[model samples]
Target: MRQFYVYILAKHRHGALYVGVTNDLIRRVHEHREGLAPGFTKRYGVKLLVYFEQHATAATAIQREKTMKRWPRAWKIRTIERTNPTWADLYEEICR
Candidate 1:
């Protein structure tokens, strides 16, 4: 079975947030960092990976992503802080 990822990117600490789902987490995040994805991420400079969740399938990931997008900003912030209190950029970690 293939895995999928639901991820959140932010412009900076406590900045604009973006929620998305992808089969290639690394590649998708890289495109966002490079300003190549085009749209909300590029326009808002939301390239820092602060949160993510994995699922067994793309459908599950997409459903979770949609749900997260509907979450209040404060709720999202708390979610990120629970696992990543510093809100560190996870691109490097994911690369490894």
Candidate 2:
């Protein structure tokens, strides 16, 4: 099955938040961090990989991304910390 990813990136350990969906989480996050990916993520400096969810289809991932994007800041942080207690640099963890 084709997989999709719903991911969130933050600036520092708790700076800014950005929600997005993609198949290549690592590359996409790298793009945001490097400023190669334009738009709000770049503008807000949301570059730390914080939270992510894998899906069986793009449609599901998109829906999840929207849901996450609409979430309040507190909820977003809670969601992220559920799986990532410290909201550490998940760039390496996601790849491994």
Output the lDDT of residue 41, model 1: 96
Encode model 2's per-residue lDDT on 6-90: one tens digit a residue: 9988887767888899998888988988999989988887888988889998888998888888889999988988999988989
Badly placed stretches (over 4 Å) of model 1 are none
Backbone clashes, candidate 2: 0
TM-score of 1: 0.97
| TM-scores of the candidates in the order shown | 0.97, 0.91
List model 1 lDDT by residue over 1-96, tens digit each. 688999999999999999999999999999999999999999988999999889998788888998999999999999999999999999999999
Local distance difference test, candidate 2: 0.87
Candidate 1 backbone clash number = 0
Q: Clash pairs of candidate 1?
A: none
* Top candidate by lDDT: 1
